[model samples]
Target: MLKLFILLSKSKFGHPTVMFRLISRLMASNKPVLANTPVPVNKSKKRPAWSMYPKLHDKVLEKLKENQLNHTFNPKDEEHSALKTYDTNIMGRFRCYNDECSSPGWGSKVVAITIREFSGNRYNARVYHQRCRECEKVGRLIINKSSYVDRVTYRIKKWNGVNMERPKWEEYSGPPHDRKLCEGCRLGRCKKGKSDDE
Candidate 1:
């Protein structure tokens, strides 16, 4: 048997058939030979049971549908320019109605208004008021009307106690002329012509 093993090893039978024959012969001899090479055992970790598919709730599905409908109806509405400056909590800048204020106006960074319609053409709308930063410094106060829809006829009260119906402007009216800035320029927090350097 040793002579046969030595003869098989010396022969250059590199084909798979020769290897299979050698393995068959070894099995037939009834004497098992231990291989020096270690057999690789897979040590992969098992996934947790909680990682299975999740169950969806009816309310969640309804909410997702509503959101999809809203987005499909008016995609631009979600991309309102005001969102760039203010979030829900922070106030942003707007153009001052007072052309001579020489300072930037004050407004909410994000303006979210909701209008509800009822029977008989009656409607309820949410309005937001933004005061001019420069005007506030003086005794006078200027408040601008902001609405969800365009050209809304809303009542506004002036400093002189005069009530007037004004039309709301578009969400974006070109670029705001009175943009808030540092305390140096005419449109900043500082007084006109007075900077921190002086």
Candidate 2:
């Protein structure tokens, strides 16, 4: 049988098939086929700490921690009661405004904060800011007033410092501004225009 196998392996017509069979048999014998090869073990690839918006990521974390501490201290404050908390883990998706480009919208996280008595205002006013994963590469920041919630409140005192009325919350009736488009779209547009001119 060994002579016959060697003859078949040596024959030009059956050489490939016989060699394949022999390799398969050798591999099935429970010994490592690549015994001479050095295999790397326990080598893990490290992911980056931040994919985009490193400064924004740190700022958001700090703000969240501060808000949590402040909430604990002023649990009963009416202003605190009106504060709205957004899910920081939830990412926002926005499409590129350039119609010619096939690039899909980027993902981002919206951070909204309302500071009470801001700049001597009677009520709490909210500001909206966004940290986009794609736009951050080009150093573009997304800021707009469209997402603001204009809640106005005032205090009234009467007669010997007696608090006649607490701060009243009123909803803003004005129409919201249009949402800002992606800055990447502008860059795409400029490139397209230059190509056309060329």
Candidate 3:
């Protein structure tokens, strides 16, 4: 039997049925291909990158500790003013979820916060959006928004007043990215113009 198996394996142009049987028998034996090879042990599951932002917030807060604002949070401020107030000075980490993009994320203050306004002069819901820095750097040729992926978990790393708390990884529970309201989305770089021939 051993001689027949070795002959079959050594045959250059062996029958398909004999080759298949030899391969199947080898796999079924459960013997290591290499001598004294270590068996692979199961590794501990790791936490997702997004889930670790609370700890990252600590490190990022150290960078943004001094850039505090005393101005009250307002929903009706002018768009530019609001963006400056909420996004300009702070540090934000964002991940890119676009297809074929391998960016883990980037840390920048390019966040856009929207405070929704309801009827009867009511204002609520702080919606946050962030752009992928890698995508922005790459610069796409077609007319498309700058890969503004959502659901960036944020925390009040430092609280100075009422109406806020040190929430643990508060995932953004707001509306989707609005291309019309996005400055990056409105830029000419993201748009394609018609040619004279057209």
lDDT of each: 0.31, 0.30, 0.33
* Tens digits of per-residue lDDT for model 1, 1-198: 454444545555334445446656666868755553221222433311111001212222233334231111111222233211211111224554442345544444333222222333222323233345555332121222222212122211121133445533344434332323221133222222232236
Per-model TM-score versus the true fold: 0.21, 0.19, 0.25
Residues 114-170, candidate 2: write the lDDT tens digits. Answer: 333211212223322332333322222243222222111111011113333443333
Can you list the residue pairs that collide in candidate 1? 86-109, 92-108, 92-109
TM-score of 2: 0.19
Residue-pair clashes per candidate, as listed? 3, 0, 0
Q: After aligning candidate 1 to the native by TM-score, how far in Å is the CA of 120 from where it should be?
A: 6.7
Q: Specify the highest-TM-score model's number.
A: 3
Model 3 weakest lDDT span, ten residues long: 188-197
Candidate of highest lDDT: 3
Q: Is candidate 2 or candidate 3 better by TM-score?
A: 3
Choose 2 or 3, whichever is better by lDDT.
3
